[model samples]
Target chain A: MSSPDSSLAEQAKAGDLEAMNQLVAEHHAAITRLLWRFARSHADLEDLVQETFLRMVRGLPAWRPQQPFAHWLQRIATNTGRDYFRRNRIRDRWQAPLPSADDAATATQPEAVEPGGDPAARAAAEEVKHLLARLAPDDAALLTLHHLEGWSLVDIAAQYGWTVTATKLRAWRARRQLRALYLSVTPS
Target chain B: MNTPPDPGDSRWDDLLARARKDQPAPLDLAALQRSVSLEARRLASARRAEAPDWTALLPFRSLVSSCLAGTCAFTLIASWQVWQWWQVMPWAQWVVASSGGAP
Candidate 1:
């Protein structure tokens, strides 16, 4: 919950390499994880992180201390992730073939090892991830920030500059959709 | 009797634990630090070498920005003026008569 300091921002703005390194270390994992989940590919993680940090470095000179640096950093990170998907959308579409039952099983189901995997659980995870991929980036982001990161609704609302009610509503709808996807993928 | 935590209930935690167990040995922090320092020095040198001659373009960039701003301001003001005139277009002759024929 504690955010980075203005002194750190100022140092990075002045091109302090140590400060830049510290900033990256502080937030890069969260950003990378978020992007990776959305991307469904680890290959995009490094590029997205680099782009986000580069933008942060460039925009540092104009940054004001009035806002939480995390929020601003997250905005940049999210936009960079979204831009990555947008640019490679077509290629990614061609590359990521439809999820097989096995692929779905591997990606979802909480990494439980059984004789093979509990087909039902794998089906559940795949259905969820597939449905999640179809969601708007904002919706996907909110869901991940809440469920995966275990962040409070208020924290997510503040981070994204959304009203608490709106965030909750979107999250609720997203969960419902994910459940529906899981059910649909289950062999009745 | 202390009950064991259900493995099924904590799959994510279990997976994370396995992942940590599978990771390679700890990185050499000192070596990493040295490499980072070296990269930093190289980046700094590169930046200095690629420094632009901003002094030469400062005047031109400033002038262009100022002129564009002024033109935009003028256009806005002119549009507002025309709009106001169109809204209350009293005849010029009638205005003169109302002012007692300019005495």
Candidate 2:
């Protein structure tokens, strides 16, 4: 992810606004999705996304080429999202309504109808989202980065400044906890 | 005999596929570009104007402030202690000191 195009990076580092915009344009969608997944609501998501870019712009001059730029960017975004959640925890305390009977029914339905659209698959996604939503924000962020984002364990380790073993262990523990929670709440 | 499928593996694979497929439509890149460029200009201007002298001054400021605070606190305590000692000391000491220790 290190744009070995030294010219581009040099320009970006030198505060070339076009270069900076280009870099953001390349990864902004993924960053937005990642932040939205971590945030509790759209407004929080938007704020975190903006803050992430602000931090990136501020910290760009200090960035090292040895690091994968995308991973660093994601780490900043994750931390910014985490910080926003921490600061706004009280404000977000309005409990979301539990899944209704119909929602559960829809989830449990089989996916045999659409030859391409996997209903069971869709159900699993919905289940994962629901289960993740119930967990702590940090746990959800960790899970999304590792599991949903499909980042390698090493990449996650570097992103979070954790050892590979620690990342793996935490991911394992989070999955186990999530499984227990999912089963207890929505007995399959 | 039909082999039983691994439920956990199947579930996670399905979920991953869904996440990958569920990307929202791409944003308006032109609009993003415009806004990002505008922001970049504003930031660059601000950076030039402020030069972020605060970071350069931070350590010195912190050291001076801490030293001043500590000195003030110590001075207050010392002055209070001296005033207390003088208050408790006998009047004989004051009379002798008044005669420059001759009396």
Candidate 3:
């Protein structure tokens, strides 16, 4: 028996607009949560989520029902995040703002933090984002998956289509880079 | 200023733990669905616009069929003319006569 998702996917592939909408509705929240880790702001999160679903719709014809739909969507979401990091890397190089003395004070303001969230955790999240922003985009994505998301190296390698050995090497290098960046910015 | 913790210390782990605790607010699913639907429609329309229209080639296709028919008719007429010329040749008559008037 085919799964409901598989049936929906087949319908969507056959150009059933209702099935397409249903598929997006079912997966939208999960995609949003997955992309939230990569977005710097709510708007960026929305954009990433939209792009991921758009890509899913475009690639529906190529998706096989044998593969789980959720896993396929997650792969698309991860790739969307990676692409966001790459675009931001280029934009930041040319348009990054100069550091202001009041930046530290502003970073912790209530308006700047998530509502009903711990300030310390929010600060830590900001720090993680800062450090990740400095590394290569792909490295940032790999480390984000391995560390923040608690994904295994093997799982990440599979998601990225990299060999296990290559994933291990990359994880090591990204960790080293993060440590160095953390040390440099820390008060001595 | 507080001294930074060493990379090997528990502080790094603590930081990662705190960072992991951060969660995004619940998204507006209805809004997202609308946007995705809109974008999907736009992409579909774009793809349709870019696809080659076989119907648009109907005139050219008809022109090609006519050219092919004309070429076949010309070839048959030319072959018949060549056969008529060959029948009137002295060598053609000599061959028929040599073969017991089998022309």
Candidate 4:
């Protein structure tokens, strides 16, 4: 028997609006959670989630039933997150103030910290974002998926359509870069 | 030579752990649904706008083919006229006289 998601996907591809909406409703929270790490605020999170679903709907015709729907959605969400980072980098280059070494050192003290969380965790998260912002978008995404999301190299490779060996090399390099950045920004 | 410590090593776990603990705020499901619906509608309308209207081009279909055919015929006729003109030219006569019409 075909899975419910496969069935829903088939209907959605056939232009069933309800099926599309159902798929969105079912996966909205998961996509939001995945993209939250990439977002700077609640509004950005919402926008990313919306973009992910829009891409999903647009891509329904190309989705194969052999692949799990959730996995496909996850890939789309990851890609959406990567695109968000790329756009942010471009915007930061033009509009945002240039971050000085001192600012990098004190990045943990983000002004727009989300209210009502474990302050330490929030600060750490902010620090992580700052460090990630310093790296290339692709490297930051690779580190986020592998380190923060606890995804294995093989899984990340599969999602990114890269070979396991390549993924391993990239992950190693990204980790080393992050470590260097962290050391530079951290006070002795 | 000493190798630098890996960030994936145990020492960096504490920071990653703390980062993981920073959960996202609860999403407004209704707002998300509304946004998706609006985007979907916008995309549908955009796709509709992009779709080639063959029917609208129906009137021009014959016009375009006629224009193409007319241009081809004009080119062929012009080429034939030029060939005829070349055959009767003074240069043609000279070339024919020089080569004894073997050319």
Candidate 5:
């Protein structure tokens, strides 16, 4: 849905302070939601959202507002989230839990599911996100935009800088590969 | 309740929908706006400062400028020499004509 922030967008484009403030205020939640899905970890959420806004302001001069302002801003958020992970991948791995000696000795054992409400649902969600993280960055972004964000093919195409047909074709390929990837990862 | 949604199928849409929860959000962006905008402006200025100078686009820019300065200096010197010759030419001709006629 197109956000009703066009007037603010127009004024922000001109560097109007009040309009920019209102515009950022208006779009923040949508930015958070977009980045939340796009982020590989919850820890990166705040930084990613902040970077998105910074990029939006940096890009304001070039934003013509022919399309919805939310679309433009969300595109920046998506890119920022992806870029944050890409840049931090090595650091993230470095920070990952080192396998303890006891854990290493029991490697062949079936892992104990963490105690939580509805282990099945939690496991499924965790698996989904894990599999999502394994997908090629573009494929993950495509799925998140199309499926998670419910963005239209046209919106996806515009925001991702692809033609409609290209977006469709790429999404098709991504989904197929993701299905295989999912099946391979999750227990039957 | 069943096997997880089939990827590449409509079932996956349900999984995606559940992931969002799609709550309507009215966020407070004032503090964030101020901070991010200030940082953005700072970065923009820094980027502008780090940006290449217009002259840097040309290889040997300083050499070209120096050549241009030398060309201007030569032109001015040549013009002055021509003006001096022009002024002295008629006088020399008149003196020759007068001296020849007197002799």
Candidate 6:
């Protein structure tokens, strides 16, 4: 996987326009997922995804091929989203509570399907997203990647340049904090 | 494979699964690809724009840009004035008068 991504990245860096387009399409879904993990609303997701690719274009010239392309791309996407939140902090504060994910979960949910997309399932999804929104950005992202995406502590730590022990400790604390919040919100 | 959860354990896994199911809205791949292409062009143009213009031949890019801009402005103004002069007095009539023909 890294080999192909690396080759594609190399071509893109060398100004192969088709290869760049292919790379954009190839990584779009994963980047979209990563954006979804942090973003509260789905309204501006396409713009965010577009911004992610745009930043990738700007950063690809200075990219080192030693590290895997996906990792580098993910880092760039994370930074792009972080910058977006930073730029929009005041606007977001003035805006109404985000209703996209939660409302979407409720609205699109089908009746009589006990699968992962049923109403209860979406409600659970809504709860988790709401919980994530309540936490700090870093904590929210860590939990989303680890719990939702099953990224290992080592992998998460590697992305953040933290020791595995530190990652584990932080994840534990974050999970406890999440649990307390969840219990407070969800009545037994 | 369905892993059975112990009775006492919290069911966060199911919730995690549900969260994972709540995907972001589907994106238009064509639009993204188009944006990527557009960005490539934008970057190329920006690079070209940032490149020092050879005509200025000056070490400082700002001065070069300004000089080039001034040259263009002067050229445009000069061109417009010349056009106006030609409109007011035809060069052919001036040539006839200078050659001692009827003006």
Whole-model lDDT for model 3 versus the true structure?
A: 0.79
- How do these models rank on DockQ, best leading? 3, 4, 6, 5, 2, 1
Give the per-residue lDDT of model 5 (tens digit) for B1-103.
1323347455555555555553222333666788767865676677777646644665587788989999999999999888677656757677668879521
Q: Who wins the TM-score comparison?
A: 3
Q: Which one wins by DockQ: 2 or 3?
A: 3
Better of 1 and 6 by TM-score: 6
Residue A112 displacement in candidate 3 (angstroms): 2.7
Task: Flag clash pairs in model 4.
Answer: none
TM-score of the first chain of model 2? 0.68
| lDDT head-to-head 3 vs 6, winner | 3
The Cα error of candidate 2 at residue A120, in Å, is: 8.4
- Of the true interface contacts, what fraction does each candidate have? 0.01, 0.22, 0.51, 0.53, 0.28, 0.57
What clash count does candidate 4 reach?
0
B38-92 per-residue lDDT for model 6 (tens digits) = 8898888877876577645666788879999999999999998876776567576
Docking class of 4: acceptable
Q: Between which residue pairs do clashes occur in model 3?
A: none
Task: Considering the two chains of model 2, state its CAPRI-style docking category.
Answer: incorrect
The 10 consecutive residues of candidate 1 chain A with the worst lDDT sum are: A109-118
Question: What ranges in model 3 sit over 4 Å off?
Answer: A97-116, B1-8, B43-52, B60-65, B76-103
Deviation of model 4 at B12, angstroms: 2.7
- Evaluate every candidate with DockQ and list the scores: 0.04, 0.12, 0.38, 0.30, 0.20, 0.24
- In candidate 2, what are the lDDT values of residues A1-188, reduced to their tens digit? 44643445567778798788877787788788787555543445556677787788778878877777787787898788666655554444655555554465355443344222445444455556556665566666677666666667677677668887777777777777776655465445
Q: List the residue pairs that clash in candidate 2.
A: none
Taking every candidate in turn, the Cα RMSD to the unseen true structure, in Å, is 12.6, 10.7, 5.0, 8.0, 8.0, 13.7
Candidate 3 per-residue lDDT, tens place, B8-99, comes to 44767887899888777767777777776786688778879764565575667798999999999999999999988989898997888889
Query: Which candidate order results from sorting by TM-score in descending order?
Result: 3, 4, 6, 5, 2, 1
lDDT tens per residue, model 2, B1-103: 2222212456556566775443332445566566666777787888877755765766777889999999999999999988777656788588778879633
